[model samples]
Target: MENKIINFGAGPAKLPEEVLKEVQKNLIDYEGTGLSVMEMSHRSAGYFKINEDAMNDLRELVGVPSNYKILFMQGGGTGMFSAVCLNLMGRTGTADYLVTGSWSAKAAKEATQYGSVNLILPKVQKYTSVPRQSTWSLDPNASYVYYCDNETVDGVEFDFVPETKDVPLVCDMSSNFLSRPIDVSKFGVIFAGAQKNVGTAGITVVIVREDLLGKPMKITPSILDFTITEKNNSIYNTPPTFIVHVMSLVFKWIKRNGGLQGMYNNSLVKSKLIYDIIDKSNGFYACPVDKNVRSRMNVPFRIGCASGHEDLETEFLKLCESKHLIQLKGHRSVGGIRASLYNAMTIAETQILADLMESFFGNKKR
Candidate 1:
């Protein structure tokens, strides 16, 4: 197989090459069924096994407790913004949201339509670091406390999970899901769009505590109701069959590669390779995020001077592409460069990027 350009996009990011190879091998005829897994019926036994194995593998990987119901839903994390509000906000008419970055802010905005949203932390000009938990004015009467585990666009991650006391802690782990080990028992609802570290787009993995189900608002759609979806085992209607199959393969790959701990270890090494380069480049490479809250999944940095360096940033991106490194461009909201070192991104690939950055800065200095 020819070498492919490294992918560093935030979502729909790179899949393990071995998993892709397995999919290619089975794309034409899956397990001698003479039909692609995508072409197979969702109700078929083969597909049932696939879905079951995926869920079981995920549970094993994350050490999810027996009380949590893992539901593979259709909508992305954006959809969960409302579903979480509708389903879980009935306990209290208000939900407290920690606005750490773009996704969490959007989620808080979406929740306002279903219930009142209390911003636990004041809005900031840039999401550089998570606010101290002590400073947050969390509502004890709120239904759930929502926060993003990792801010994809801003590249800020929580060094410690927020403690909400009696309030259920709801987390959107979209960008950094499966990149590290998490205490599943602490969260009431943990949802992630599969496009990131899991598989592809079209499926969302939702792990909700059993107590959180059966409590949607009166106007909640049947599809968005966790009770109904969990009762049917995430197949009340036609599911994202192909995406689930791919995700099953991803689960297997994660297990083969040593589960969550292994992924976490690799994440540290890969992220450090780039962060080390940025820190050692004097002032050439600048990371806006606080050192303590820097994300291991996404590293967003700027080239050249901090201000009025668009030309240098553009030239840096072009040079990266020429070296077969792609998707290094940052999100439009915070324009610069973002290197998403997902689970599939190898140390070798990260080294190439670090070398590229060093060379680019060396050349610019000359």
Candidate 2:
């Protein structure tokens, strides 16, 4: 294995070494242009192609159909929180949202600023699992239904695609984007912050259905309007050039690694091994997410205590850090441990983590 430390960071997470090497190679001079990607003008052909390639690769990777317009915008996923409301609020009285966890709750909160929000907080105690859809209180005439496909903070995920008909379905895929194959056609909008599976921070990706464009609510900013940005090819203003370039490199890496299906297979193996460790640990280590709805990309588990026990968890994290397994801390909202297994995380790294977990937990299924 490589000598570099094993990275388990949640977002701004690990990227493929091959992509890093390519970025390094182009850091100084990009394709004999005598300028780094950072130095190039956003309007220039070189930078334009970089943006186009990033979008095109994402489109192909997710099998985005002709109906969807891919836009690389600034302001991350939070931007979309307002953007979604601004664009769709005019259609109906309120927006419907599933309050699965923190991210979705934040989305619901943001939507309420523009209009009334009908938050569907599924009843499953302590954010431990996703409730069955039969129990979800979906609004029939709602402008749109918003949900976070995976909650990074609480480590809960929707194992099945939500069932929604004509009402547009919006998803905050920030924590779980591109970690597995998805049906792009089912949703009216899907947005992700680039920091997770894409490349770096500072950029957001929006895949909006073509039919859903053209009419933002009166309060919507011009830049936030999907139709306006789509018309301008996401170049309405000087876009995040450096971030887009890095995203393009990452996209190429994903293609090389066999696209979405490959990501699905790789994620399955890596996450399964880690979850297996947690599952077999008995009470020694416990995964908070319900087995039916656990996120394949983000796994949050408790070691040696209930909700209030932070000391032992911190010690375990420090021990893991000493061994070069980094960023296993859970989000502040839900205290425990979190292991983010993104596309760039290798199977071997997870194997090492499983071995460590085994060794640390008395070498027996707890």
**Candidate 1 local accuracy as lDDT?**
0.91
**Residue-wise C-alpha lDDT for candidate 1, range 205-235, written one tens digit per residue:** 9999998888899999999899999999888
Candidate 1 lands at a TM-score of: 0.98
TM-scores, in order shown? 0.98, 0.96
Worst 10 residues of 1 by lDDT: 1-10
- Per candidate, the number of residue pairs that clash is 0, 2
Best by lDDT: 1
**Which lDDT tens digits does candidate 2 get at residues 1-366?**
544588898988998899899989989999899999998999999988898888888888889999899998887899989999888878885888888888887788888788898867644547777777888778889988889998988888888878878899999999888888898989999999999899999999999999888778887888888888999999999898988988888888888888888998998898899898878766788886778988889988888844535776877888888888899988877778899999889998899888888888884334
Point to the candidate with the largest TM-score: 1
Runs of candidate 2 with Cα error greater than 4 angstroms are 1-3, 122-125, 306-308, 363-366
